[model samples]
Target chain A: MSEPSGLESLYRELILDHYRRPRGKDLAPTFDAESFQVNPVCGDEVRLRVKLGAASSDELGGTDILGQVTWTGTGCSISQASTSVMCELVRGEDLGRVAELEAAFGRLMHSRGLGLESEADEDALGDAIAFEGVAKYPARVKCALLGWMALKDALAKAVAGDSSPAPGPKG
Target chain B: MTGLSPETVTSPTNAHGLCGPGGLPDLGAPREPITPQEVERIRRDFPILARKVRSGHELIYLDTAATAQRPSCVMDAMTWFANNNYAAVNRGAHLLGEESTEAFEDARARVARFFGATPSEIVFTSGTTAALNLIALSLGELAQGEPPASSAVPHICPGDRIVVTQAEHHANLVPWQRLAARTGAELAWIDAGPDGRLNLESLAALIDSRTRVLAFTHASNVTGAVTDVARLVEAARSVGALTVLDAAQSAPHLPVDFRALGVDLAAISAHKMLGPNGIGALYGRREVLEQLPPVFTGGSMVEIVTMTEATFCPPPGRFEAGTQPVTEAIGWAAALDYLSHLGMDRLAEREAKLTARLLDAVTGIPGVRLLGPADPADRLGVVALDIEGVHPHDAGQYLDDRGIAVRVGHHCAQPIHRALGVRASTRASVGLYNTEAEIDAFAEALANVRPYFGATQ
Candidate 1:
């Protein structure tokens, strides 16, 4: 098969821009809860830190939930950009709602099920949709998923409150 | 730009079928008897050489260390065998089966002769990794008191030493490591010099009376530095240690005579020498092989079997436990024949000239640091280099943009890279068909790498 051109949709300028300057790339000074995640296939790593605050949501009765989420890690552009978009979408949401968001993101990236319908609230995942082209390149799918997988692990750790640190990148 | 267009001038094949009776085209002939023209004709025999990548750019394959392109003769031989003589060897009573067995044995005989050993001593393996693993497991069995009934063999104790080199590829290193872990034996390593060549002086110290096996590579897959097998064999012999030579790289490029080298056992791969993948051969001295217990046992290897007990065949068959890759063996034998026809001496000479050209070109390029011997005489046509301020992966990507293929990363010899004080380096390895023109093109591409990366050369 012919190699995909560098200027094509996969290597789009926006992806390179995100790779060069990733947003939401910082750790909370004192995270109420945090988790470390890694993509074992490749050596991409990410640490997801969440801060729970006593802010009530109109949709739910007065109850404290995770108020902010931030991430810091090293990985390829797809992974980093995906995590950036993920952090932006899930921030200020209740901790109980994380499972649904994770499942939705997994379906989109892995191409296993239907994607979420376009809505004004879904604008946070703008850069991540750029990676829909990556599903075609099976060898590179892992590269795109490195960050999101790390987030999954980190979230699990944060829920457990036993976060030391994840294993370092393997050779 | 002349009366004849550039396209016409470039069409050397159309003007004179290079492989036709007259001989190859003269594109700066070499001092070797096999001129540059002859090499081009030889290159034409390998159909894969004509392939293009990245639009119209010709494929400049330099990853022979990973796998070599097969010549038409090898491919044709394998095709003929599968189409005409396909049958189960050794076990069948039919005519086709017997014919297939004879052909298979004939291939074994050819391999034995290629390495200057008896047919009985050659064991067909999946590849060099399997051969090395077989040797390691067999030795482990012997060390653990799983010996044949006829003779009692010495068992390895906790204090016994298995000597290996730090420069060894993981194939040579990992099995021994596992063996040491299992047997409680100490694994001693011989260090490589700053130039990446094996330090034979240190190897002498490493092999003492307690050393039961001395394993080392005939050539470093990463550095391309050939080892002094004579010195190593002598050192191991003085300590009464059986020697295992990893000839995966050397056998493909040079004239390897296992009998003359006097190693107890040697392993080589077929794919590295322009043959099909999934087949390799292990050469063991007849007496030594007879003494060693089989690593695997089943099917064709058994002499006779009862519910309670079984008798095994000797040497090659004893080690060969399963149905073999018959087509692959035939292909490898054909590859050997092609190499023989070219004459190893002539092939080596051609490669030496190309190695010199590559060495000169890379050395002249600023910011490029060669990993092994700066002089081409001390090395094969494999050059591993680090371009200053540019990671090997980025450098490899730049070369890839130009249709030039090279291996990046640690090249699966992490210890060597660690010893050399680098995370990874890009490598360009040559095969029989590589030309000086390709080397020049490689150098030109490499020259553009540092600048492209915005690194000062």
Candidate 2:
């Protein structure tokens, strides 16, 4: 058989698995802050609730830990898959580490179909590396970045003592 | 390659260039649907039709409802006008200015003739959105209980109601909503049936003495259901209400006679009819247009100007404010000439067959649900579909990858989509130049969407 095309690479079985049976797909009844994000171009939406736990004290400035991340959304497979993979990767991580990973993924997207150079950055993104092909399509990058942007907004709202984060367009 | 003859490729230029100036072509009786060979010849005139997309796949553009592709002659006209006769219209005294002004006015007369109207009744605006906005704002001014002493139209008071259909494109719908809000008039709508057809049976109950204006679409951009204009006109006339038809979607595909339809006013965009962008025309009955107030006021649209006040020009000029889209108007006239030669009735009949083929192919899929009438005769070639387990954006992407470009989302008619119980849908609309092969490719590509998304059983 001929080698799989870029579209096939973008819709890998692992990505489809997360999209079809998403983890943390339910809304949390109680959360510190909640954010609803929408992709106006395609009308995809995600409402995410984030809970922050006590910060770890080992570092000079203790980084807040993510206690739970849950969301309810309706969107295309790329967005759904990105959100599910994000929840799996960052649920138990420190906020600082999550930010680092988010930044790394952003860099991967900006690479424009050329993925991360270092294995370390690939490891940081984990299954999100599957979205590297998706980033090639400038029109669809918003779909892949919806969840991460929502997470950042919800965290900011939680820090500001606001109960609801404003919904925003990511791309 | 079709290896089209050189004669057919240059026909639009010859037909338009040599036609007698100052007289409309008597486009005889409605012709039959074009044969396959005729379609091939028509396709040769559009350069974009020959191009390829991703990995050498041929481009199948199925998004004409969003915006129709321009024929080579339309582009040529715009370029030729801009390069040869570019000057400010109706203002300067230079030779070039007079030439530009003459070309611009000639275009207006051409557009008016196309719609069975007089040049005095056609007002050029930026596009359909601007044209509709001009009407709504002007009507809002009229409804404010004040008519200039020179105007003869009656005032629309607080208790008046403005009626519209749920199927109107946002351009037509939102402006009326705003007009009602500004004038304190009641805003009401005629809802669509289960199959996305407008419920004309409810018109008598909806329109009464208090109804001042009844605005609606000639054909829906999303559902493809052509409105029953005769019944709508009869009902609106019975109530003595002004009827405003949004012919943006219909004028390109069908023959639209404003006089025969007997509507008080209408709006059509050149870009949606295989013309240049940034140009639309508003058609009004001469007597009715004379009374409508100007929404926008500025330089070229005035009759007399003082330090403190200004008197407006005649009907068409009164509504057109500021520097107009002069070149776009000339391009629009050329575009009209192109469509008139092609014969709108023949194009409509051809599109009906293509609509049937698309409906059959898409609806035959096990999980596909069409948003409009199942009878292809009731619809045009605009087909919006909702797959059971695929988002329209995803379906759109799959089609795009296969070099089939279709429109996705609410199509700017959110209420109709909500009424049809879908947040968004995938639409495959056609233009005069589209082929049966493209329709088949669209259907074949759509069948693979569910499997690609891993949603198929």
Candidate number achieving the greatest DockQ relative to the actual structure = 2
Maximum-lDDT candidate: 2
List candidate 1 segments past 4 Å from native: A1-4, A7-124, A128-137, A169-171, B1-32, B146-154, B364-368, B387-394, B450-457
Which tens-of-lDDT digit does each residue in B1-457 have in candidate 2? 1221212212236423421233336758437668898778777767898899875778899999889987777777667667767788888777667777877888898899889998998999888888888889888787675556644343667778899999989999999989888888889999999889999878878899998889999999999999999998899888788899999999998899999999998999999998788899888888888888898889888988989999999889898888988878877887787787778888888888888888889988878899999998787788999988888988888888788999998999989998999889999998888888889988888888897777887
DockQ of 2: 0.57
Minimum summed lDDT over a 10-residue window in model 2 chain B is located at B1-10
Q: After superposition, how far is residue B224 of candidate 1 from its true place, in Å?
A: 1.7
TM-score of each: 0.83, 0.93
Runs of candidate 2 with Cα error greater than 4 angstroms are A1-4, A55-62, A117-120, A164-171, B1-32, B145-154
Candidate 2 colliding pairs: none
DockQ of each: 0.17, 0.57
Please give, for residues A92-130, the per-residue lDDT of candidate 2 as tens digits: 788888888888888887888877887899988887898
Across A61-119, the per-residue lDDT of candidate 1 in tens digits comes to 66556676777875555666667766766677665566666655555566632344545
